[model samples]
Target chain A: MSWTRKHLLGLQDLSRDEIQLILDTAEPCKEIFTRPIKKLPTLRGRVMVNLFYEPSTRTRTSFELAGKWMSVDVINISTNLSSVAKGESLKDTAKTIEALGADFVVIRHYAAGSAKLLAETVQVSVINAGDGAHEHPTQALLDLFTIRDKKGSIEGLHVAIVGDILHSRVARSNIWGLTKMGAKVTVIGPPTLIPQEIEQMGAEVSYDLDEVIPHVDVINMLRIQKERQVAGLFPSLREYSVLYGLNRRRLDQARDDVLVIHPGPTNLGVEITSEVAEDPRASIDEQVTNGVAVRMAVLYLLSGGKDIP
Target chain B: MSLLIKGGRVIDPAGGIDAPADILIEGGQIIGVGTDLPAAKEELPAQGLVVVPGFIDLHVHLREPGYEYKETIASGTRAAARGGFTSVVCMPNTNPPVDNKAVVEFILAEGARNGAVRVYPIGAITKGRRGEELTEMADLAAAGVVAFSDDGNTIMNAVVMRRALEYGKMLDLPLSVHCEDVNLAGQGLMNEGRTSTLLGLPGQTRAAENVIIARDVELARLTGGRVHFAHVSTKEGVELVRRAKKLGLRVSAEATPHHLTLTDELVATYDPNTKVSPPLRTREDVEALRAGLLDGTIDCVATDHAPHSRDDKEVEYSHAAWGMVGLETAWPVIYTHLVLTGCLSLIQAIDLFTRKPAELFNLPGGRIAAGQPADLVLFDPKKNQRVTEELLVGKSKNSPFIGQELQGWPVYTIVGGQARWVDEIGR
Candidate 1:
């Protein structure tokens, strides 16, 4: 019940009541997102360190933007360019970063349980940016905010997060978030990409993306997973695009104003066509805008820096 | 160090001894076991209590190296002590199976570091417990591995079983089998019977486990090897082992607390805690196993001490795990349920707890004997303890026996001449 210093590593850790409270707190953050001057001095002088052990552009930028808007010093330590490339382990790198007075860290790693380990090692509060294909709680939070901001309510709306459900930590995090908010989430992807027990987490799962896209109110298209292509997932990317990819024609088949969403650095034509992405109804920039507010809320909730609310 | 266990009924079954006696223990071995022979420096009176050899269980699941959340050696051994056991054989079904010397040493070192009860780690026969290849038996034996088993999974191939048996005999390593044919028991959740049929759950047949037992018995016979069938649940499996023993082949078996007490009917509730592999069988199976234990056909009762977190068990019954943590409830249940029912004599019950398993595993334990290791369970036999979930020392609360009321509880468990655990001993 007390949202103080607890690890927001995954949405699974949060109960329905806890999630609802987060949504309520994020309601004001969402309001601030659409303002002409979209900034808040909520976390002034706080250091938000982006210790992404894995590479990222979108999630890192979102956290950095959230930090900067709150007047916090943001440090971007990409594992590729940082001292981690010079044989520094994740634990030591985090320790070094923590020693530099990082109040909170938004971490992303390639391994499923990396964030959990880093949390135990450091004294600083950890906001799981993404954990080794396990969870990206802020992404789920932003997605929830985006849906509620557009639809006026989180509950009872049919939401479909489509793509490689197994590899995408976003899909897992979103499933937990969306389901907790009382929305019925249908996960649409290829049979193999659909996790072994998708429905067990209270989400309806389907393999045929075409049948699913027409029914859902919000369609969240995840990135086309290229890592599994060599493992004989599909014949090629073109063939996959033919079956599962969302083209302009696919978008035309949806309801009149169904929100076409993608967590970005989009694959452009693979999961969604450029025509569909640039549509007036996409609200993709709105999602990016809501991302900052949602992350600010997460950092506030975790760092005992829960603003004067 | 010395311990004077005064005024208790000593049941040393292997020596065919019973009745009240005073035990003088020194340097972790029993020095004297009889009526009032010598006055000791430290006299701990055990008046009107049950004094027996420290209990030994041949089978226990200590999930370490990879899955520490389930059961660590520290917690598992602590649970064993709570169950009145002093030595327990840890199964090798870890993430990286205890096939290599490094892993075996790691498990041993953990036991030594904790040093609650003596942990005898059973090395995995196959590398990674894949059931494809065998581990270096000689090398593992040198590193102090007493037995070998792939506990969670079975080696289904006969060629592998035969060769393992032959080579296992060459080094005196007993091949403890988790007897179940994977193909027949494929994806089944519970035991195949009237109950599973009614519940619409896929059930495993007794035939699945028995077929493997029959095959392993033949392999053990062909190679003149010793085979220990672990956690024998089915009526048919026990019958096969009983018959195999009659044929002069070296075959013995262990019955778990669940198999002896619980039945497949609990599966109707759809609780995953009751969901064990080689699933809990019919009441007929339970009765037969109990009868076998009474007549000395079933050798000993082993606690297959499995532990898991709440989330691991919160899922659907078919998807959840197939085990329950039992070390904390073993002695109380066995004593109250079996001994009080006249199914087993108190002395006989004590023997199964001590000498039977100690003799079975060929470990120098499970006796209140002179020159033996000072491993003993100082129990207040008259004390009827009600088991709550809070009573367990282990981190896992996956016990199905919560709120179980039973008589006969261990008060002080002394391992290696020191009091490792003493329930209300000081107070």
Candidate 2:
């Protein structure tokens, strides 16, 4: 149950036993949030730095809150707020941070292999918040945690992931994580938005979200950027929403207990309608809540927490 | 000063000879060859080595004058010598582009001044390689340019390409083309396939290369100008060239060692070293390129020896420069993967490296005979060479073949009767 890896760059390299251990660890961490006194001294003397090259409000804040709750000191170094804007390399910046006695470094970069690059550059335990269209391990871990918590087990579940599979790091991570845990993953998107030969990654590809809804135990909607529309991958937002958007009308086709998840901030009325996103079956808010717990479990285990109950 | 290369299996594809022989060199030319030749001051005993007429690389980028930080005439040719090349035809995609006589003369002068091997300059097909305007083709040809090319960029306009071919036909020079339609290829970092999909990187379809080859073949047919497709990578691209050849069009194609050995799967790791123009293809394409070489479809093997600085390659896959330094690793990779694997005979591989490319440019030194220039390489075909950064002779060590344990190491690279590079172990 002890974490041996110094880095969590991607879920693609993680083992099934290791993934289960992380999900199990996050369960106890989630229970603490339900209590009135939600703080822990697990990493009291530890220092964590969130070095994000890309802008993020949710993931950064969640990791900060997770660290603060564990009594760990957290620092944020975003590109615009630091000397990274002066064109310093990730290597030089990470080395400077590591030299400052950081115990852990959480990085989100616009380059696919930046997290792995930083991991090789520093001695500190590195965690990938997100790296280009590569992976978002904690997001996928929280997603799996939410799915398992709601449905009782991960095995024998059919999960349909809709929207821009080509550019979704979340989809990449989820494809690796969910498939490792025995979930059959169906990636539903337009042909332009779906990467070629994604089936090689152990997932089925589909263009019609409507036809795929009824059979899946879970549907994770990835955010469709306005930039993708500007890049001319699809015709228009209206057409996209009409064709692939999940709404109340489309929700009726799914099983009553089918879970809807979105890695927000959502394109609200485009990929998913306001009605279905706010529906009780939707696990959007729960995913955000579990994100904090999942991050805490990652920090705790990477900081030398033994596998003790 | 004179030298004698004694007792080696000499392979001269153009001369139709592959036998144990002795070569006597004096005044930078072959004076005699056969058993029991007259002795010289310097004797290189090549008992187990295989000797071949100097390897001629038809496509190489000696990034001098403008991008000397990447490579220079001195360093690039030295690296070429280490790779067993006795001569390399420099591509004209330099900063000022070898479009005019001035640049062409400057390249020739620089090569004469610093080159370890014979350096033949290829003039730009169009002015500045922009594809809009044509260069002074007649003047460039008179300046001793072996061929004309805008190697890093394609002539997209059909009319311009046709005109260049017509003019080149009049001048009796080959138009070496870097065939990839930019419109179809668009910002694609790797080959379009399962690997590009799994990695989420943009993919360039094989048709990007095939379409242009098809167009150029027709242009060659129309003008009767010799068209040499540079770094041909796709199966369909090779098929087009093959069909063009069958129809008796003046078309020839060259394949790189990378395209013959590697696939787009290497791009899955996001290694920028694997990023190349006409991007590395699938396994089927590699086999097709190998088969093409064996069946006389691919005329030669050229190391599109593009050298880029460290910063150029140490970036995101999309932002990384599009090339790999092939001159140093070309023979070893080709020998290990193709010849040893029984895909091509040793003489066939030597022909692709020497005679075919020499015939393409009509250059000298593809034949090892009396009175021919003493441009040759003594190769240890079974010698093991592990590619490493420190072992690289070029200024830019951007080869993807690093860490590969390859057979066939050149023991002596003699250019103009002088030893350019001699393996100390062989001594």
C-alpha RMSD (angstroms) for model 1: 9.5
- At residue B73, give the lDDT of candidate 1: 89
lDDT of 1 by residue, B290-315 (tens): 98897777899998888887767754
Candidate 2 lDDT, B1-427, residue by residue in tens: 9999998999899888989999999999999889988889989989899999989999999987789999999999999999999999999888888889998899899899989999999999888899988999999999999999988789999999989998788899998999889988876778887877666677788888889999999888888989999999988888898999999998899999999999888886777899888799999999889889988999999999999888888766666898999988899999999899898899999999998998888999887989999999999987997999876899998989899999998879999998998887654
Report the number of the highest-DockQ candidate: 2
Error of 1 at A34 (Å): 7.5
lDDT (CA) per prediction: 0.81, 0.90
Model 1, CA-based lDDT = 0.81
Candidate 1: deviation at residue B400, Å? 16
Error of 2 at A33 (Å): 1.4
Write the residue-wise lDDT of candidate 1 on A180-210 in tens digits: 8889999887785665545767888788878
What value does the lDDT take at residue B34 in candidate 2?
Answer: 90
